[model samples]
Target: MDRAALPGGVLTGLWQRARLVERRIETPTAVTLVLAPAEWPGHLAGQHADIRLTADDGYTAVRSYSMSAPVRDGLVEFTIQRVHDGEVSMYLCDDLPIGADVELRGPIGGWFVWRETETRPVLLVAGGSGIVPLQAMIRQRRAANSDVPFRVLYSVRTPEDVIYGDELADSADGVETTILYTRTAPAGSGRPPGRITQADLKTHGWTPGFDASCFICGPTGFVETAAKALVAMGHDSHRIKTERFG
Candidate 1:
Protein backbone atom coordinates (compact mmCIF):
# COMPACT_ATOMS: atom_id res chain seq x y z
CA MET A 1 0.00 0.00 0.00
CA ASP A 2 1.08 3.58 -0.61
CA ARG A 3 1.92 6.02 2.15
CA ALA A 4 -1.34 7.85 1.50
CA ALA A 5 -3.20 4.74 2.44
CA LEU A 6 -4.24 4.22 6.03
CA PRO A 7 -2.26 1.93 8.30
CA GLY A 8 -5.22 -0.45 8.35
CA GLY A 9 -5.31 -0.42 4.54
CA VAL A 10 -8.49 1.61 4.70
CA LEU A 11 -7.40 4.17 2.07
CA THR A 12 -8.42 6.91 4.42
CA GLY A 13 -7.57 10.41 3.32
CA LEU A 14 -6.40 12.37 6.32
CA TRP A 15 -4.05 15.01 7.61
CA GLN A 16 -0.41 14.49 6.74
CA ARG A 17 2.83 16.16 7.65
CA ALA A 18 4.07 19.00 5.45
CA ARG A 19 7.39 20.77 5.44
CA LEU A 20 7.80 24.44 4.66
CA VAL A 21 10.07 24.35 1.63
CA GLU A 22 10.18 28.03 0.78
CA ARG A 23 8.97 31.29 2.23
CA ARG A 24 8.57 34.64 0.51
CA ILE A 25 8.05 37.90 2.30
CA GLU A 26 5.21 39.62 0.51
CA THR A 27 5.04 42.62 2.79
CA PRO A 28 5.87 43.77 6.30
CA THR A 29 2.97 41.89 7.80
CA ALA A 30 2.48 39.10 5.30
CA VAL A 31 4.46 36.07 4.15
CA THR A 32 3.78 33.20 1.79
CA LEU A 33 4.94 29.69 2.43
CA VAL A 34 5.42 26.88 -0.08
CA LEU A 35 4.89 23.46 1.44
CA ALA A 36 5.17 19.88 0.28
CA PRO A 37 2.95 17.40 2.06
CA ALA A 38 3.84 13.76 2.29
CA GLU A 39 0.34 12.72 1.23
CA TRP A 40 -1.06 15.50 -0.84
CA PRO A 41 -3.99 14.58 -3.03
CA GLY A 42 -3.78 17.88 -4.89
CA HIS A 43 -6.03 20.86 -4.30
CA LEU A 44 -8.22 23.23 -6.22
CA ALA A 45 -7.66 26.96 -6.23
CA GLY A 46 -9.07 28.87 -3.22
CA GLN A 47 -9.19 25.83 -1.02
CA HIS A 48 -7.47 26.11 2.38
CA ALA A 49 -5.44 23.96 4.73
CA ASP A 50 -5.40 23.81 8.49
CA ILE A 51 -1.90 23.80 9.91
CA ARG A 52 -1.18 22.28 13.28
CA LEU A 53 1.76 23.06 15.52
CA THR A 54 2.74 21.63 18.87
CA ALA A 55 4.79 23.29 21.54
CA ASP A 56 7.33 21.45 23.64
CA ASP A 57 4.80 21.12 26.44
CA GLY A 58 2.25 19.48 24.09
CA TYR A 59 0.24 22.62 23.53
CA THR A 60 -1.10 22.44 20.01
CA ALA A 61 -2.28 25.34 17.92
CA VAL A 62 -4.12 25.15 14.62
CA ARG A 63 -5.08 27.79 12.11
CA SER A 64 -6.35 27.67 8.57
CA TYR A 65 -5.02 29.60 5.60
CA SER A 66 -6.31 29.57 2.07
CA MET A 67 -4.18 28.49 -0.85
CA SER A 68 -2.63 31.51 -2.51
CA ALA A 69 -1.96 29.89 -5.87
CA PRO A 70 -2.90 26.87 -7.87
CA VAL A 71 -1.54 23.52 -6.82
CA ARG A 72 1.69 22.63 -8.58
CA ASP A 73 3.75 19.43 -8.35
CA GLY A 74 2.15 18.72 -4.97
CA LEU A 75 3.41 21.98 -3.52
CA VAL A 76 0.66 23.92 -1.75
CA GLU A 77 1.11 27.63 -1.15
CA PHE A 78 -0.46 29.66 1.65
CA THR A 79 -0.08 33.39 2.22
CA ILE A 80 -0.48 34.37 5.87
CA GLN A 81 -0.76 37.76 7.49
CA ARG A 82 0.52 38.36 10.95
CA VAL A 83 -2.17 39.35 13.40
CA HIS A 84 -0.40 40.86 16.41
CA ASP A 85 -2.67 38.98 18.79
CA GLY A 86 -2.88 35.77 16.79
CA GLU A 87 -0.45 33.23 18.11
CA VAL A 88 -0.49 30.92 15.10
CA SER A 89 -0.10 33.73 12.63
CA MET A 90 2.66 35.33 14.68
CA TYR A 91 4.61 32.07 14.61
CA LEU A 92 4.05 31.56 10.90
CA CYS A 93 5.08 35.07 9.86
CA ASP A 94 7.89 35.71 12.33
CA ASP A 95 9.50 32.66 13.85
CA LEU A 96 8.68 29.50 11.94
CA PRO A 97 11.91 27.95 10.76
CA ILE A 98 12.34 26.90 7.15
CA GLY A 99 12.21 23.13 6.60
CA ALA A 100 10.17 22.64 9.76
CA ASP A 101 7.32 20.16 9.51
CA VAL A 102 3.77 21.04 10.50
CA GLU A 103 0.68 18.89 10.51
CA LEU A 104 -1.63 19.93 7.67
CA ARG A 105 -4.96 18.82 6.34
CA GLY A 106 -7.19 19.93 3.56
CA PRO A 107 -7.98 21.23 0.20
CA ILE A 108 -11.03 21.96 2.33
CA GLY A 109 -13.76 24.48 1.50
CA GLY A 110 -15.84 23.76 -1.58
CA TRP A 111 -17.99 26.85 -1.93
CA PHE A 112 -15.26 29.43 -2.46
CA VAL A 113 -13.00 27.39 -4.72
CA TRP A 114 -12.47 28.08 -8.42
CA ARG A 115 -11.76 25.12 -10.65
CA GLU A 116 -9.82 25.52 -13.87
CA THR A 117 -12.75 24.10 -15.84
CA GLU A 118 -14.85 27.22 -15.34
CA THR A 119 -15.15 28.80 -18.78
CA ARG A 120 -17.26 31.85 -18.23
CA PRO A 121 -15.95 35.36 -17.73
CA VAL A 122 -14.40 35.61 -14.25
CA LEU A 123 -14.66 38.58 -11.91
CA LEU A 124 -12.70 38.82 -8.70
CA VAL A 125 -12.88 41.54 -6.05
CA ALA A 126 -10.41 41.63 -3.22
CA GLY A 127 -9.68 43.91 -0.25
CA GLY A 128 -6.59 43.85 1.91
CA SER A 129 -4.92 40.43 2.06
CA GLY A 130 -8.12 38.84 0.88
CA ILE A 131 -6.43 38.87 -2.50
CA VAL A 132 -4.64 35.66 -1.62
CA PRO A 133 -7.39 33.23 -2.60
CA LEU A 134 -8.62 35.26 -5.52
CA GLN A 135 -5.06 35.42 -6.78
CA ALA A 136 -5.09 31.63 -6.78
CA MET A 137 -8.05 31.61 -9.10
CA ILE A 138 -6.29 34.03 -11.41
CA ARG A 139 -3.25 31.77 -11.51
CA GLN A 140 -5.41 28.75 -12.26
CA ARG A 141 -7.06 30.55 -15.16
CA ARG A 142 -3.68 31.36 -16.63
CA ALA A 143 -2.19 27.95 -16.08
CA ALA A 144 -5.05 26.33 -17.94
CA ASN A 145 -4.39 28.58 -20.92
CA SER A 146 -8.08 29.17 -21.15
CA ASP A 147 -9.23 32.32 -22.86
CA VAL A 148 -11.71 33.10 -20.13
CA PRO A 149 -11.72 36.85 -19.66
CA PHE A 150 -10.59 37.84 -16.14
CA ARG A 151 -11.04 41.08 -14.23
CA VAL A 152 -9.91 42.03 -10.76
CA LEU A 153 -10.90 44.98 -8.62
CA TYR A 154 -8.36 45.20 -5.81
CA SER A 155 -8.95 47.64 -2.95
CA VAL A 156 -6.10 48.64 -0.71
CA ARG A 157 -5.36 51.39 1.78
CA THR A 158 -2.29 52.55 -0.08
CA PRO A 159 -0.17 51.62 -3.07
CA GLU A 160 2.31 49.95 -0.76
CA ASP A 161 -0.21 47.55 0.73
CA VAL A 162 -1.23 45.84 -2.48
CA ILE A 163 -0.38 42.18 -2.25
CA TYR A 164 0.93 40.76 -5.51
CA GLY A 165 0.80 44.29 -6.81
CA ASP A 166 3.46 43.83 -9.47
CA GLU A 167 1.76 40.79 -10.96
CA LEU A 168 -1.61 42.50 -10.82
CA ALA A 169 -0.17 45.54 -12.58
CA ASP A 170 1.41 43.35 -15.25
CA SER A 171 -1.91 41.73 -16.11
CA ALA A 172 -2.21 43.58 -19.39
CA ASP A 173 -2.19 40.55 -21.66
CA GLY A 174 -5.66 39.21 -20.99
CA VAL A 175 -6.65 40.19 -17.45
CA GLU A 176 -7.59 43.68 -16.33
CA THR A 177 -6.82 44.88 -12.80
CA THR A 178 -8.17 48.05 -11.27
CA ILE A 179 -6.72 49.49 -8.13
CA LEU A 180 -8.92 51.39 -5.69
CA TYR A 181 -6.83 53.27 -3.20
CA THR A 182 -8.88 54.14 -0.16
CA ARG A 183 -6.18 55.95 1.77
CA THR A 184 -3.78 57.00 -0.96
CA ALA A 185 -2.98 56.46 -4.61
CA PRO A 186 0.31 56.39 -6.41
CA ALA A 187 1.42 59.70 -7.84
CA GLY A 188 0.03 60.56 -11.28
CA SER A 189 -3.13 58.48 -10.79
CA GLY A 190 -5.98 60.95 -11.15
CA ARG A 191 -8.60 58.87 -9.39
CA PRO A 192 -9.40 60.10 -5.92
CA PRO A 193 -8.87 57.78 -2.98
CA GLY A 194 -12.13 56.29 -1.72
CA ARG A 195 -14.00 53.15 -0.76
CA ILE A 196 -15.66 50.96 -3.35
CA THR A 197 -18.84 52.75 -4.24
CA GLN A 198 -21.87 51.75 -6.30
CA ALA A 199 -20.55 53.86 -9.17
CA ASP A 200 -17.25 52.10 -9.12
CA LEU A 201 -18.96 48.73 -9.39
CA LYS A 202 -21.13 49.85 -12.27
CA THR A 203 -18.13 51.25 -14.04
CA HIS A 204 -15.68 48.38 -13.65
CA GLY A 205 -17.85 45.35 -12.96
CA TRP A 206 -19.89 43.05 -15.15
CA THR A 207 -23.54 43.73 -15.59
CA PRO A 208 -26.19 41.27 -14.47
CA GLY A 209 -26.81 40.48 -18.10
CA PHE A 210 -23.30 39.08 -18.54
CA ASP A 211 -23.81 36.23 -16.06
CA ALA A 212 -20.17 36.41 -15.07
CA SER A 213 -18.97 34.29 -12.17
CA CYS A 214 -18.03 36.72 -9.37
CA PHE A 215 -15.82 35.98 -6.41
CA ILE A 216 -15.39 38.56 -3.65
CA CYS A 217 -13.10 38.26 -0.65
CA GLY A 218 -12.13 40.73 2.02
CA PRO A 219 -12.97 41.94 5.48
CA THR A 220 -16.55 41.23 6.52
CA GLY A 221 -17.62 44.79 5.84
CA PHE A 222 -15.98 44.93 2.42
CA VAL A 223 -17.39 41.60 1.32
CA GLU A 224 -20.87 42.50 2.50
CA THR A 225 -20.84 45.84 0.74
CA ALA A 226 -19.45 44.44 -2.51
CA ALA A 227 -21.88 41.55 -2.58
CA LYS A 228 -24.79 43.86 -2.01
CA ALA A 229 -23.61 46.14 -4.77
CA LEU A 230 -23.59 43.24 -7.18
CA VAL A 231 -27.08 42.24 -6.14
CA ALA A 232 -28.43 45.76 -6.51
CA MET A 233 -27.02 45.81 -10.01
CA GLY A 234 -29.27 42.86 -10.89
CA HIS A 235 -26.57 40.25 -10.59
CA ASP A 236 -28.02 36.84 -9.78
CA SER A 237 -27.33 36.12 -6.15
CA HIS A 238 -26.50 32.53 -7.01
CA ARG A 239 -23.62 33.53 -9.24
CA ILE A 240 -21.75 35.42 -6.51
CA LYS A 241 -19.50 33.60 -4.07
CA THR A 242 -17.98 35.38 -1.08
CA GLU A 243 -15.30 34.58 1.45
CA ARG A 244 -14.85 36.92 4.39
CA PHE A 245 -11.85 37.45 6.59
CA GLY A 246 -11.33 39.62 9.66
Candidate 2:
Protein backbone atom coordinates (compact mmCIF):
# COMPACT_ATOMS: atom_id res chain seq x y z
CA MET A 1 0.00 0.00 0.00
CA ASP A 2 1.26 3.43 -0.92
CA ARG A 3 1.82 5.61 2.15
CA ALA A 4 0.80 8.69 0.17
CA ALA A 5 -2.53 7.07 -0.59
CA LEU A 6 -3.34 6.62 3.08
CA PRO A 7 -6.17 8.66 4.53
CA GLY A 8 -5.25 11.80 6.46
CA GLY A 9 -6.36 10.55 9.84
CA VAL A 10 -4.52 7.31 9.30
CA LEU A 11 -1.34 9.09 8.31
CA THR A 12 -1.33 11.84 10.93
CA GLY A 13 -3.54 10.43 13.59
CA LEU A 14 -4.92 13.20 15.82
CA TRP A 15 -5.68 10.58 18.44
CA GLN A 16 -4.58 11.97 21.75
CA ARG A 17 -5.53 12.34 25.36
CA ALA A 18 -6.84 15.78 26.19
CA ARG A 19 -8.04 17.65 29.24
CA LEU A 20 -11.10 19.90 29.24
CA VAL A 21 -9.94 23.23 30.60
CA GLU A 22 -12.96 25.42 30.13
CA ARG A 23 -16.62 25.30 29.12
CA ARG A 24 -19.08 27.89 27.91
CA ILE A 25 -22.83 27.60 27.48
CA GLU A 26 -23.44 28.76 23.94
CA THR A 27 -27.14 27.98 23.94
CA PRO A 28 -29.69 25.86 25.70
CA THR A 29 -28.59 22.75 23.87
CA ALA A 30 -25.01 23.61 22.95
CA VAL A 31 -21.84 24.07 24.93
CA THR A 32 -18.29 25.01 23.94
CA LEU A 33 -15.48 23.05 25.52
CA VAL A 34 -11.90 24.26 25.50
CA LEU A 35 -9.53 21.36 25.46
CA ALA A 36 -5.79 21.38 25.90
CA PRO A 37 -4.40 18.58 23.83
CA ALA A 38 -1.15 17.06 25.02
CA GLU A 39 0.04 17.27 21.42
CA TRP A 40 -1.69 19.41 18.80
CA PRO A 41 -0.33 20.03 15.30
CA GLY A 42 -2.67 23.01 15.01
CA HIS A 43 -5.71 23.38 12.77
CA LEU A 44 -7.28 25.68 10.25
CA ALA A 45 -10.56 27.49 10.43
CA GLY A 46 -13.52 25.22 9.53
CA GLN A 47 -11.77 22.01 10.47
CA HIS A 48 -13.39 19.46 12.79
CA ALA A 49 -12.40 16.64 15.14
CA ASP A 50 -13.62 13.22 16.10
CA ILE A 51 -14.37 12.78 19.78
CA ARG A 52 -14.58 9.31 21.28
CA LEU A 53 -16.13 8.73 24.66
CA THR A 54 -15.85 5.51 26.66
CA ALA A 55 -18.21 4.28 29.32
CA ASP A 56 -17.39 2.40 32.46
CA ASP A 57 -18.48 -0.83 30.78
CA GLY A 58 -16.11 -0.12 27.83
CA TYR A 59 -18.92 0.91 25.45
CA THR A 60 -17.81 3.76 23.24
CA ALA A 61 -19.58 6.52 21.34
CA VAL A 62 -17.84 8.57 18.71
CA ARG A 63 -18.90 11.86 17.17
CA SER A 64 -17.37 14.68 15.14
CA TYR A 65 -17.66 18.34 16.05
CA SER A 66 -16.28 21.42 14.34
CA MET A 67 -13.57 23.61 15.74
CA SER A 68 -15.26 26.81 16.79
CA ALA A 69 -12.22 29.01 16.46
CA PRO A 70 -8.59 29.04 15.39
CA VAL A 71 -6.19 27.50 17.88
CA ARG A 72 -5.67 29.92 20.71
CA ASP A 73 -2.61 29.55 22.95
CA GLY A 74 -2.38 25.81 22.28
CA LEU A 75 -6.04 25.26 23.12
CA VAL A 76 -8.72 24.05 20.69
CA GLU A 77 -12.40 24.60 21.30
CA PHE A 78 -15.42 22.69 20.08
CA THR A 79 -18.95 23.99 20.24
CA ILE A 80 -21.15 20.93 20.42
CA GLN A 81 -24.93 20.68 20.23
CA ARG A 82 -26.80 18.13 22.27
CA VAL A 83 -28.43 15.46 20.20
CA HIS A 84 -30.73 13.78 22.72
CA ASP A 85 -30.43 10.36 21.16
CA GLY A 86 -26.76 10.73 20.25
CA GLU A 87 -24.65 9.30 23.03
CA VAL A 88 -21.49 11.21 22.14
CA SER A 89 -23.23 14.54 21.71
CA MET A 90 -25.22 14.07 24.89
CA TYR A 91 -22.08 13.41 26.91
CA LEU A 92 -20.12 16.27 25.41
CA CYS A 93 -22.95 18.74 25.82
CA ASP A 94 -24.49 17.71 29.11
CA ASP A 95 -22.71 15.05 31.12
CA LEU A 96 -19.05 15.79 30.53
CA PRO A 97 -17.50 17.77 33.35
CA ILE A 98 -14.73 20.31 33.19
CA GLY A 99 -11.27 18.76 33.75
CA ALA A 100 -12.42 15.39 32.51
CA ASP A 101 -10.37 13.47 29.95
CA VAL A 102 -11.51 12.40 26.50
CA GLU A 103 -9.99 10.82 23.42
CA LEU A 104 -9.92 13.02 20.31
CA ARG A 105 -8.59 12.93 16.78
CA GLY A 106 -8.48 15.64 14.16
CA PRO A 107 -8.65 18.89 12.62
CA ILE A 108 -10.32 16.42 10.22
CA GLY A 109 -11.70 17.36 6.81
CA GLY A 110 -9.43 19.40 4.61
CA TRP A 111 -11.68 20.50 1.78
CA PHE A 112 -13.90 22.69 3.98
CA VAL A 113 -11.25 24.99 5.35
CA TRP A 114 -10.70 28.66 4.55
CA ARG A 115 -7.25 30.21 4.15
CA GLU A 116 -6.18 33.64 5.25
CA THR A 117 -4.36 34.40 2.03
CA GLU A 118 -7.41 34.52 -0.19
CA THR A 119 -8.40 38.15 -0.66
CA ARG A 120 -11.53 37.76 -2.73
CA PRO A 121 -14.88 38.65 -1.31
CA VAL A 122 -16.43 35.80 0.65
CA LEU A 123 -19.97 34.75 1.37
CA LEU A 124 -20.69 32.44 4.32
CA VAL A 125 -24.04 30.81 4.89
CA ALA A 126 -24.78 28.82 8.02
CA GLY A 127 -27.81 27.18 9.58
CA GLY A 128 -28.48 26.10 13.16
CA SER A 129 -25.35 24.83 14.89
CA GLY A 130 -23.51 24.70 11.57
CA ILE A 131 -22.17 28.11 12.45
CA VAL A 132 -19.38 26.55 14.52
CA PRO A 133 -16.67 26.24 11.89
CA LEU A 134 -17.78 29.26 9.93
CA GLN A 135 -17.40 31.31 13.08
CA ALA A 136 -13.75 30.31 13.03
CA MET A 137 -13.33 31.91 9.65
CA ILE A 138 -14.82 35.14 10.92
CA ARG A 139 -12.52 35.09 13.91
CA GLN A 140 -9.43 34.33 11.84
CA ARG A 141 -10.22 37.11 9.40
CA ARG A 142 -10.55 39.57 12.23
CA ALA A 143 -7.41 38.38 13.94
CA ALA A 144 -5.33 38.79 10.81
CA ASN A 145 -6.93 42.13 10.03
CA SER A 146 -7.44 40.85 6.55
CA ASP A 147 -9.47 43.13 4.36
CA VAL A 148 -11.29 40.27 2.76
CA PRO A 149 -14.76 41.64 2.40
CA PHE A 150 -17.23 39.02 3.55
CA ARG A 151 -20.80 38.62 4.68
CA VAL A 152 -22.74 36.01 6.63
CA LEU A 153 -26.32 34.87 6.22
CA TYR A 154 -27.24 32.94 9.34
CA SER A 155 -30.61 31.19 9.59
CA VAL A 156 -31.86 30.09 12.96
CA ARG A 157 -35.07 29.24 14.77
CA THR A 158 -35.17 32.57 16.60
CA PRO A 159 -33.03 35.33 18.05
CA GLU A 160 -32.57 33.43 21.29
CA ASP A 161 -31.36 30.41 19.41
CA VAL A 162 -28.43 32.28 17.87
CA ILE A 163 -25.05 31.25 19.24
CA TYR A 164 -22.33 33.89 19.48
CA GLY A 165 -25.10 36.43 19.00
CA ASP A 166 -23.47 39.31 20.81
CA GLU A 167 -20.05 38.67 19.30
CA LEU A 168 -21.47 38.58 15.80
CA ALA A 169 -23.50 41.68 16.56
CA ASP A 170 -20.49 43.59 17.82
CA SER A 171 -18.37 42.53 14.84
CA ALA A 172 -21.07 43.36 12.31
CA ASP A 173 -19.26 46.45 11.11
CA GLY A 174 -16.64 44.61 9.06
CA VAL A 175 -18.63 41.58 8.04
CA GLU A 176 -22.34 41.95 7.59
CA THR A 177 -24.72 39.36 9.11
CA THR A 178 -28.35 38.85 8.24
CA ILE A 179 -30.29 36.58 10.55
CA LEU A 180 -33.39 34.86 9.20
CA TYR A 181 -35.69 33.56 11.86
CA THR A 182 -37.72 30.58 10.74
CA ARG A 183 -40.02 30.27 13.72
CA THR A 184 -40.26 33.71 15.30
CA ALA A 185 -38.77 37.18 15.16
CA PRO A 186 -37.89 39.65 17.84
CA ALA A 187 -40.05 42.73 18.29
CA GLY A 188 -39.76 45.48 15.63
CA SER A 189 -37.88 43.30 13.16
CA GLY A 190 -40.14 45.01 10.59
CA ARG A 191 -40.59 42.10 8.18
CA PRO A 192 -42.26 38.86 9.17
CA PRO A 193 -39.93 36.03 10.10
CA GLY A 194 -38.98 33.69 7.27
CA ARG A 195 -36.34 31.30 6.02
CA ILE A 196 -33.52 32.46 3.80
CA THR A 197 -34.79 32.92 0.30
CA GLN A 198 -33.28 33.65 -3.11
CA ALA A 199 -34.12 37.28 -2.65
CA ASP A 200 -32.19 37.45 0.61
CA LEU A 201 -29.10 35.94 -0.97
CA LYS A 202 -29.21 38.28 -3.89
CA THR A 203 -29.74 41.36 -1.77
CA HIS A 204 -27.26 40.46 0.93
CA GLY A 205 -24.82 38.17 -0.87
CA TRP A 206 -22.35 38.80 -3.61
CA THR A 207 -23.64 39.15 -7.13
CA PRO A 208 -23.03 36.08 -9.28
CA GLY A 209 -20.32 37.74 -11.36
CA PHE A 210 -18.44 39.27 -8.46
CA ASP A 211 -15.87 36.46 -8.20
CA ALA A 212 -16.81 35.83 -4.62
CA SER A 213 -16.06 32.49 -2.97
CA CYS A 214 -19.12 30.99 -1.36
CA PHE A 215 -19.06 28.62 1.63
CA ILE A 216 -22.36 27.23 2.82
CA CYS A 217 -22.73 24.94 5.84
CA GLY A 218 -26.04 23.54 6.96
CA PRO A 219 -28.47 20.69 6.61
CA THR A 220 -28.27 18.73 3.36
CA GLY A 221 -31.42 20.31 1.96
CA PHE A 222 -30.32 23.83 2.74
CA VAL A 223 -26.90 23.29 1.20
CA GLU A 224 -28.37 21.84 -1.98
CA THR A 225 -30.95 24.58 -2.27
CA ALA A 226 -28.48 27.38 -1.66
CA ALA A 227 -25.86 25.89 -3.98
CA LYS A 228 -28.41 25.47 -6.73
CA ALA A 229 -29.67 28.99 -6.22
CA LEU A 230 -26.15 30.41 -6.43
CA VAL A 231 -25.49 28.56 -9.66
CA ALA A 232 -28.81 29.69 -11.09
CA MET A 233 -27.91 33.26 -10.23
CA GLY A 234 -24.86 33.06 -12.51
CA HIS A 235 -22.21 32.20 -9.94
CA ASP A 236 -19.58 29.74 -11.08
CA SER A 237 -20.51 26.29 -9.84
CA HIS A 238 -16.91 25.46 -8.99
CA ARG A 239 -16.61 28.47 -6.70
CA ILE A 240 -19.45 27.39 -4.48
CA LYS A 241 -18.43 24.82 -1.86
CA THR A 242 -20.62 23.23 0.79
CA GLU A 243 -20.50 21.27 4.03
CA ARG A 244 -23.75 19.53 4.79
CA PHE A 245 -25.16 17.74 7.83
CA GLY A 246 -28.43 16.06 8.76
TM-score (all chains, Cα) for each model = 0.92, 0.93
Residues 184-212, model 2: lDDT tens digits = 99998765787778888998899977899
lDDT of each: 0.82, 0.82
Top candidate (TM-score): 2
Candidate 2 C-alpha RMSD relative to the actual structure: 4.3
lDDT for 233 in candidate 2 is: 89
Q: Give candidate 1 misplaced runs (Cα > 4 Å).
A: 1-12
